[model samples]
Target chain A: MLTEERHQLIRDQLAADGKVLAGELASRFGVSEDTVRRDLRELAKAGQLRRVYGGAVASAPFAAATLSQRSRHAVEEKTRLARAAVGLLSAGQSLFIDGGTTNEAIARAIPRDMELTIATNSLGVASALVDRPLVELIMLGGRYVPNLGTCVGADTLAAVAQFGADLFFLGSCGLDVARGVTAFDSAEAEVKRAMVKNSAGIAIAVTNDKLATAAPYRVAGADAIRHLVVERTAPAATLADFQSQGAQVHFA
Target chain B: MLTEERHQLIRDQLAADGKVLAGELASRFGVSEDTVRRDLRELAKAGQLRRVYGGAVASAPFAAATLSQRSRHAVEEKTRLARAAVGLLSAGQSLFIDGGTTNEAIARAIPRDMELTIATNSLGVASALVDRPLVELIMLGGRYVPNLGTCVGADTLAAVAQFGADLFFLGSCGLDVARGVTAFDSAEAEVKRAMVKNSAGIAIAVTNDKLATAAPYRVAGADAIRHLVVERTAPAATLADFQSQGAQVHFA
Candidate 1:
């Protein structure tokens, strides 16, 4: 068969079978395995399929903005805050992580050697630790909202109530001395409230954009939060205001 | 040297060091590199090993829950059935998904644009669909089982019975005509029983391994399942046995 024909056939098989193994394809098509591997290599380069150890599998398009979208916003600032957050955690400690880009960064920043039991409502946070053999993850169940990838509703609150966490890393859409920490979505706000109530300590991670802005749904008052992590660009006046409200402000 | 002799030696070399170099093999066999390459090529063609840049490596280094190891077990066939399973879902439809490798593939196979309400007891499933804004996820809560990464016990079964799903994708540890559907763990089997009872349509996703193997605990009778998805490698007699039991058999 022609090389082009072989390529077309591989694509067809991949679409039908979810993968094409080099060995199976080689004997069936009367070609060298090298040739088959070469075809898989070319197909992988064309973004038709993802190459595995012995084969190539059909893949979902990179349409869902999971990593790039989260990492793109406030890359340097989030990294700094994540480093600071990890400093607070020890080898054997349990914590609660609410869903958001900032919280996702903190989960990623966790040291590999640390053995912690992390209870989370965020799908993103759970996935980040799946392969980490030492880290035990307890996922809170609830009515899931897709874009934010968080579990909320009554069930999520009930799940949160079950866990008595040492610390809570809360992500907020808006953080202010007057309005406290806020969220744009009501369901997410509800989950955040549970995270704050169930944990012994609350730390809010926010960028400078959220400093003065107040979102519609209020998660907690300023006094509920113990630590405020902000970017260096945050206004000095706002920092003083948060500190005055009994929040220990930490600049990333 | 004989072809079978060369094959056996190659297998031994691979078992010891995990790889076989083309140049070293040619010199050891006192044959041209082309001859050695041809032998390696045939081994690759037989699925005994995977051809690499300078040599061949052991076909599957399966040990962990990493993505590559998960994809090695009849991935093409599983993916094919997973694609078919997602076709049964529609917008606003609620479904129950149990935890297992086949069920994980089904979760990954969901179209990015399809808007469906997904209720799952699988951490893998929840994570796969987390970034999808259109699909809503409801995670079932229970005692977390690390190896399975699933929720089970009274809480999980209670969670299962609460939802009247349009469909339920049940993952089976074993399947047969006489023994029916079975799971290795008693907790998983209990949860599967609830899923089968609660959903309108029951579909069991199985690779070829589970076709005739019956485990200790029974999840459901063969008559209870509406659809049985199996790989093409599934024996014709086994397929007929399942069909005779009133299930609509689908070969991926």
Candidate 2:
């Protein structure tokens, strides 16, 4: 069979059986195990599947965001916002962080020697903080969302609600002046709302472009947010308008 | 058409399209949207597929251990080991925790007010520590292993070796007088061994039933372990045997 044919067949098998063993695929395709592995590698690079030891599994349902894709959307804005957000942290304070590429950056930007308690839903954030000796990491438990590399659901929300964090670092799919913070998933939005409500202060991390966008699910309104942290060059007048309305704007 | 036939058709559509939209499936299967949603829910419950907001997607290949299934095994024994393990801890002490079911129990058992630095490979451990006011949690990064909910790779091993932790909390798939500490995955074993080599002291947490079993991969020998922390009712003679082999055996 042709290589593309083999790849297609492998994907079909993965969908049908939920996993594919290298030896089994090799024998079935009449190819060397090395060839099967190569095929799996190529498919993985294409974001079609995930290769595991001696086998391959179906990729997570939501497409895994590439590093470049994550870095591009509002890069400088996220960095400035991260700096401003980290400034709120004090020694011995507790925090709850939601999952977002921007939040991962915030985890990295946190000082290594500050005595702080951090509760988060992002695996990326948890992994980033693994070596910071002064930060206490608390990962909330719930159903694992493979695509996002985090946990979510009613259980996760309930767990977050039980702890009153001094500050909450939040991310959103879109933020409308009137509709509030919105996300693509309703369940995740509920979790975000729960986090916002449970924290003493709320910091919305966003780029200038995301300030007026709208998604399917509403988490909260702009008025509910305590801080609007944005990049230095973000529309100052637009930010001022938000500050005038209610939010305390921080231009980092 | 029969319910089984309808189910099979929906499964086939999901396999072909990667997702089955509720409206599309409803029309194709000559069923109502509610009926399709119900079918998707049932499939999700069976672990045959995942139900999303508007449709269903294929489930990931690996079977995740249920929370209750994990909670039951080694409950009492792990609690005993946790108490003994915490005794080794002090304010400002840094530690490395290996990934396993029992180590997760140890993470949960940590005192809420103890000030310490904790590095771990287990997601369960990190999540359990999220809310504690005094614990600093670091999660080591590597290739994420879904079944284990931890990262393991050469990078993870190298990162672990860079730190000299005050204590290392270790777990094993099996432990034997002849083989010492064993793990199911070779990659996990490599990381565990690296952790043991980088720590000031090593404590092995195991239940009595795993006393003499050997697994596919070896982590270390009994001589390298500083403390063998086990439950109170574990055979005293077995503890003596380990102590005779140069391990500091402690029963809690």
Candidate 3:
């Protein structure tokens, strides 16, 4: 088959299945895995799809939406993920939580009776916890980005360095096996990197829309995440990929 | 009149007139200003009235309410003061805003088109400014106090030191001529004092209830405040006292 024909077939398969495996594609087309990988590389370069560990997945359609716009999207799915993420917590654990609408949902879902020490750079996250008496909240200060509803820049980075928490709820823009964790903003990516480095373990609660996706800035490898909360409707093969990376997967 | 009768009359005057000038009281009672000062001191110690520059005024009774509760009280009065406070701003100026429902109202009242740099320790304040594109917000990081709805402790004090802004909108628990600016929380008081020291000028917006009241920790003297925004219903004597101390008084 011509290389363009193979690329077209891969795109159709990815569109239909949300992801495509290199080995399966290679065997099905009677071609080499290297050839399939090359096709994925070209597709990803063209922004057609995202490359994963052994395949590529469709990019999220609304990744460029503002924070408020994103908060209103997938409310039920994010809430399910939030409830599952809250289940992973104990009564008195200190947490390093990054800023995102999903994380804001998690903040709201935290039980009022639970005693927690949560440190965050997100105003939305902190505001959700303001009325919870048992929670000791720490806000990281910096230049506030209205679009993200979070504080970023040097002051935030310095503030985040003070605490090494037991768990970190990462704000993910995209998650892929091959490319690891990713984000849309460079400064936000830096903050997430610092958070991953400072925390004892990292937990990420994402909707299925973020699975097998890739963004511009890389945060860390998928192997670095210790816990992941996603929808039960996520692709089984994608769940297996994360499981292979040694992450404890929870289905919401 | 006997000493006890004179004291009762002074208390009555403070109640009826909202304040009692020591010199005026002495002249009315055919006594020296020293005698009137002694009477004022005794009343202040008893918490019956607050001592100001030249007299005593009625103490604000609802000083111990929680932040959320306070936000709900005097909605119209606060909005009026907030509007007046916003009028003080010019485009491109930087402001250090302290935490309070009044300051939050000021945050909300800031024009969307105005270009400004605002640094705050209040989650409510930052949340209010999150949607404004022209404002660059800086949050002071520290331990969050739900009761006050702001960050406090050592880290917040340290974060506040990094900037010297054009003006500061002080969060006042009590504003007095003699006792000066005061707050109910010691840590919050420290944060406010740091904000005052780091800014070029200090402004405060208060409802009629806060005038001449005194809380536990001293923030600064009324003389330190360069701008004062208050309800038009505030006593003329109190307004004159602040103006006499060099504060540019604006009545809402």
Candidate 4:
């Protein structure tokens, strides 16, 4: 069969089966395993599939966002929020940061000199923080959420509630006057609520565009957050309105 | 600090700063950039740090049990359990297996030709099955639990609930006459419960040693399982007792 045909067949198989293995594909197509591997690699590079250790998995079905694609959205705002969030952290503090693109950026911005005990639900954040000597990472074991790249459940919620962190960096799906901070998934919302309740301070890291949006799950009301860190300036009237509702608004 | 002390200081600095840019560390230590890179390489080899794209960061912390160490515990029993579990599977049958050493073996035992839909919470199982073509694999995403080598959470539970599988291959931390199947972690217990509820048949894979013991978190009762696949032949009387309770017991 032509190489294009083989690749198309593989894609079809994955769409039908959710995953495709190398050896099975090799024999089915009457090609060597090496050829199949190469095909998978090319398909992965082209954003057609995700190449795992020995095969390929359909890209996350819910989000439909690649790692790079998710990374690009609101990059500047995430960076600014990360910078501001990092400023609140001091040496010898224990912190919990929810998993999201913004929190991942904050994890990267953490200075190496700062000593911290971090408990996180986000695999991306945990993996990023792994290389830091001064940071003692406690990964809360729970159900893995592929789309969010984190873990959440009753056990994760219970684990987070037991620790009182000095700071909690939270990411939201949407922030609005009515919903306050909301998440796309209910499990994630539960985790965020637990983090806020367990931490000494709650800071919401949001990009400018998320300011007026509302998702399905409401994590907490505007009155619950201690700080709102955003990129650039929010409307002065809106900032005052939030401040009046007991939020300390900070423009990065 | 003296020059020798300065080298130590730089090492300390690297520990404090996850990564040290050659120019930045050199400027801070009054050493050449080449010297900083060499220092990083040395630390990397010592397993104290990792070299990144442009600099160095601390290495990922080593867990107590290496992958190979943990793989040794239930080898014989897992092999037997895996074989028995595979016997229950046929073409186009969807299966859910929880993460454990036994399930890892079952993942390896799956025949490549019997078209199957396998869903799992274990990264090891997913990676092992990656070479099998006829087996459709779906990974249940949650927080990566290092000890269990899988993800767990509400999302993980939700993901598992999305499909009704023909069979479930489960690994238990302990099993008792009364408490039934238990797990070391509560979050895992929750995920296992969902797995059991969604599958048509449940097979408990236990090493001889884990039989009759009970862990902290109870996943299900002995009566809930359809089969008990173990490494060794249990006492005939014990087998009879279990059989009376509605479990079809098999010696691996």
Clash totals for all candidate models:
0, 8, 0, 11
Most accurate candidate by DockQ? 1
User: When superposed on Cα atoms, how far off is each prediction in RMSD?
Assistant: 8.8, 19.6, 20.8, 13.4
What digit string (tens of lDDT, one per residue) describes model 4 on residues B161-235? 776888888888888768888999989999999999998888877776777889999898888878887666665
User: Residue A218 in model 1: shift from native, Å?
Assistant: 1.6
Model 1, C-alpha of B221: deviation from truth (Å): 2.2
Find the 10 residues in a row with the least total lDDT in model 1 chain B: B61-70
- What is the model-wide C-alpha lDDT for candidate 1? 0.76
lDDT of 3 by residue, B1-252 (tens): 445446657755543334678889999999999989987775553334567898876432212232214444475578678899999999999999988768877887888799999999987777667667788889999999877878999889889999889999998999889999999989999999899889999999998889999999999998998999988889999989999999999988
lDDT of 4 at B149: 66
Give the alpha carbon lDDT tens digit for every residue of B1-252 in model 2: 444345556655543333578998888878899988877875553334567788876443211232224344445556667778777678899989877766766776788778888877686576556545466556564445655666687546655765679889987788888798888998898989899888888888887778878999999887777888887788877777788888887777
Listed models, DockQ each: 0.27, 0.03, 0.23, 0.06
Candidates 1 and 2 compared: the better one by lDDT is 1
Which of 3 and 4 is ahead in lDDT? 3
Chain A alone, TM-score per model: 0.73, 0.72, 0.73, 0.71
Residue lDDT tens for model 1, A112-187: 6889989888766665555456777787888877666677888878778888788899888888778988899988
Report the TM-score of the second chain of model 4 against its true counterpart.
0.71
Q: What are the runs in model 1 whose C-alpha is more than 4 Å off? A: A1-73, B1-66, B70-73, B87-92, B112-115, B131-134, B153-155
In model 4, which runs have C-alpha deviations exceeding 4 angstroms? A1-73, B1-252
Please give, for residues B1-252, the per-residue lDDT of candidate 1 as tens digits: 998899999999999976788899989999888988898889888878866657776664211232332323456667787987776678888888988767877888888898888899887777666667788778887656766768787767766766788888988888888888888898888888888888898888787777889999998888888888777777999888778878888767
